[model samples]
Target: MARDIADDGVIDGLRAAATADFETARAMPPEVYTSDRFLALESEHIFSKEWYCVGRSSALPAPGDYLTCDLAGQPIMVIRDNDGNLRAQSNVCLHRMSTLLQGRGNAGRIVCPYHAWTYNLDGSLRGAPAMSRNSGFCKDSYRLPQVRCEEWLGWAFVSLNPDAQPVASRLGALEQMIAGYDMTRYSEAFFEEHVWDTNWKVLAENFMESYHLPVCHAGTIGGLSKLDEMICPPGHDAFNYHTILKDESLRIACAHPSNDRLSGDDRRMTYLIAIYPSLLITLTPGYFWYLSLLPKGPGQVHIRFGGGMSDDFKGDADAAENFRQLKALLDDVNIEDRGCTEKVFRGLSSPLAQAGHLSHLERPNYDFARYLLDRIETGQGAV
Candidate 1:
């Protein structure tokens, strides 16, 4: 039998750490990452109730374009309807409970592979083969269950909970803070999915803080980092962020000449934003990238990684080459992060593993732990 999360003393440790000041705060207990019971609690109270980022709206620009994902064990799809509106609906067919769509592509209508049951782009039941003899059948009575989906700054978010708060309202401050970037104009260059052998939170924390950059990323962007220039401010209820000014040598990371909105230090600044539960974004003046995380279980994470160039740089003579180099550099950074996070998970499983004091740079990690605890303990719906 699995150990109960509440009785294993992990909650007590997290509670204490969550409430501590930065000077005294410690890393979360190891069991929080290694316990099946705790993962179950997170699945129920956190993942199921929060707004999860699906990706940029541009990825499904045309009618009939759609993408599928499993949110907290519920299979859902975000599709562009015939009217060019994005809609979230249960991907399961109503008749035999079979998945109606796989992976992602353009579809005039949802057609079930198990049977010939079909649905319109709006999710209305269009037809059911050989059902005319069934006296009780009513095609008008059935429709795919709708899920809450909203667009904020061109990114699409979906939630299973009907009563979940609107994402834009909670993130108004964030939008204002990044208004100059005009994130909606940044086009996605690539999007890929991968699974790593590590707890989701571990990778999230790694992204939240850059304290390990000098050592772990020495072969890549580490040399360009100026530790003293990095800023870690108090996070809000909805998100946490830190900014770092890029070195001049990495010209594409700095604002393009055409961008008049940013001046002085802002030209080279990069913001690492963590929108609670699981979206991490690195917004730079010339480009942007993000990771949308989902836990596979106690020991593995599913990652939706995508990024693109800012519109300001699109007219530059060297724009294509600059983006190519930037993507290659980012790939190298991910390789280092994968190795580090997987090692952390392995260490967490040892009997001698223990939490350690956090650095000032890790303030975001501390704030994230508190967010998790608040939701897991009180069942708070959304940020």
Candidate 2:
């Protein structure tokens, strides 16, 4: 009498909607955006099993600097240990299961505010005050469970699955494609968290295709875009990308004068890369910004937003001014996208909402739907 989380009808509809060829592809089923059951499937299959990007590596420059994230309902922490290694471990206390940290800051040891149980920076139990009274209390037996953590380019990623493939191995092609940009040298200038009332995919799709730029971002960078200049290629297994040539007027979007690696259109090109399961980056020649997404439920998404200028601009006298202007523009762009994506979620909730035909510009969206179906279907088989 229980409802099936992986409804056969919905799976069939999703498969039909996710065809690779744009000529035959359609929008994903509305239930994909509206069903709590489907979100549960995604959490189990995609979020938990796949590598989730936390943020840039440069953010944790010194030992003891740490950040905490709630990934698929599992509270995890990433810290720079005394050995200069980035480690990810369970953030919950082993003794009473209390969360050990709040927001990000430097800590010599993780101390549970509840009972004063403490852990070293490397997650080994440092002390359990007065615990020797108990017969079975052994400090050697207690350490926060370690999670898989990796640094790809400059981003920090963590996966809950022990056997998950290495992040660098999965993203080799992406690295080669972006080699000229030297993304690792780009520093993190700012990071922020926000919750929006929209399905995560809606915002992701909005980012994948700039088809809505002229309308949704009309007040900001929209007018600078040209549909003909946009290129949405078929996605790879781990990621997808589209490129647009920045208008000459937006100088900061183009390569800095000292950047000699890129030539021709590549110098002015901006690559929109969506690393599956939820890291979306806008990599321009001189600057980059990204959104790492986590779903709150079917109706809302939590976003980690950050960006900074390329190292090529580090010595330029105008670099600071350029970044300030760029940040302001991006903030305005985010406001526009929120309004548009939130409205789409509202429409998707309607009884009359139906899957529609795809525009060639929306090829990445179609590919994303296929990625979702593949992960969820394969996960169902495992279960």
Candidate 3:
């Protein structure tokens, strides 16, 4: 006899199961989305333990080039040293723990403005003005604490914990899927960020669902993928890593306006993949965009969208026009989706809310949530 998926009991909540089954469902519990205590647990358990993508490596192309960004509430500096090697270190000065750099720049060395402690671009302590001669003060012992850093598909990933698995090892087959693509052939054209109020997991769940595209993104993604065609399978396979939502009709309408574009292979399509924990990569024929999610608190997250282009897209006049159109379309889609998610965050605060379910179509997202819950529950977190 065949097994009933309902009998598996993979889901363990009333509202959770209900919400996953219905399209117009209530939001998750208020505490899970709005509690500071829960947010701190996310910082300790999930953010600290997993490999998180901060920004693209293209943001720092030259030696001594650096970008200061936060890692799970802790400030960090990702730099390319004089030797062209990338390194991650705490962005706080060792003296009084002051923030070293506020943003991105090219620097000869990292200097503390407070007490003037200077460190090499590689994070090695080189000088401590006025304090090198202090008793028992050894420059060797004062180097900045380093964090694990790695680059994949031209993006930079950082971890706050020293014992976290190497980024590559944790990615497993994901690394190979992206490796096949010529990632270095692209460069950023524009970048922008905005903050949303919600649990980081909520945003992850939202991304995994395509059911809302028709209604929420009518002006953009709705113009392309229909509901049935956007159905995605569950797995950590290549498609999951580099999946494409093809719609040749839309592509032709945007590309060769003079030609009556119909259903075909060269028509419009959207490809989106996640570099697990915090990076979303999307591509169309004309443009490529990466969205990085930074959790600021239980109810707050920063989302950045950066666009890039391949030589093929850059040189072709037709492709450039299509790219611009797609960019505008994507911007609209993102704004609409964010509005929906933000509204859900507010609704999550209702007193009657509870946990939700996982639909077969939403199994990937459910697995992701469970994976995060396991990590946070078992990790060194606030009890």
Candidate 4:
């Protein structure tokens, strides 16, 4: 059984250790944001332990359906057997730890090329091609080790820890908050990833603040938000999650003539939600975008972006085209953001760089730093 995350003392200690005062600085301590050891701690405690969005349930639409992914250095396979239940298992073959699958595909059973060890689509040992009877190995008892798996809002999440809490409990209020919108009805139209030469924290902190708009992202997002009304939301002050509203200028630009679903309140604002650890969900009138920051090393991170159209627009040709256009615009925003991130990473390591102050409107960045440090310092989410 997975441990109860809600009552875990470690999580409580993490929340309590947050330093409200430390967040006022220009940046986190040099080691906290740049050390290799610190980065590894996060991988173990944060990425490996938590429920990470690995793919969409739609990716495995039938029995014998499976997808392979490497998350936090662990190779995992997610499958929905013929009966339609989802299961996650180590992609490593029990026989020699060799990877069972290379990528996504349909397979009635996974067989290890090295040893002929085979596992059913549900991850049970189905056979061992040539093991002699005297070898004394029981196929029925040697099934692939199963990992915890769950689905929320069409996204499939898997936890390396076999005893982690259910996806619903870990997600808390996020489901209800987005319940009115159905993500399962949508389809992925765009996927792209790039290496960011900075600590994962740097990128996450950047997303939490709108202050960079007038400068860093000025060419792309600045004109869309009013310089003054772009203040950070107060929601970051608590353990509370945040979603930002897009200004009217950007809202109008995102809604194309092909998209009829952009009318009403949905067209009025852009929504940004920061899920703890490393998941970011952004909702626009025409589509929803998810960004996952997977740490590659001390000063490098893999950023993957997934874009999907609104459920209502999935079948409409014109609406789909508008969503594709929206994705292109988002890609532009990502490029603009990455350009600034590269420069910032260089500065963080320079002797000339000193800690800076937080503007009133950039308080969300403060909250993020505070939470990150708390998790690191206490070893609660240490990799």
Candidate 2 deviant stretches above 4 angstroms: 1-6
* lDDT values, one for every candidate: 0.91, 0.90, 0.65, 0.68
Order the candidates by lDDT, highest first: 1, 2, 4, 3
Task: Candidate 2: give the clashing pairs.
Answer: none
User: Which tens-of-lDDT digit does each residue in 278-319 have in candidate 4?
Assistant: 777776555677777778776787876787776555556576
Question: Against the hidden reference, what TM-scores do the models get?
Answer: 0.97, 0.97, 0.82, 0.83
TM-score of 4: 0.83
lDDT per residue for candidate 3 within 324-353, as digits (tens), equals 776776688778878888877766666655
Candidate 1: give the clashing pairs: none
The per-residue C-alpha lDDT of model 3 at residue 28 equals 37
* Candidate 2 residue-wise lDDT at 245: 92
lDDT for model 3 comes to: 0.65
CA error at residue 318 for candidate 2, angstroms: 1.8
Worst 10 residues of 2 by lDDT: 1-10
What's the count of clashing pairs in each model shown? 0, 0, 9, 11
Q: Per-residue lDDT of 1-383 in model 1, one digit per residue for the tens?
A: 22235533777777888988878999998888988878888999999999999889899999999999999999999999988899999999999999988888999999989888999999999999999999999999999999999999989999998888899998999999999888988999999999999999999999999899899999998988788889999898889999998898888888888899888999999999999889999999988999999999988999999998998878888889988998999999999999999999999888778899999999999999998889878873334
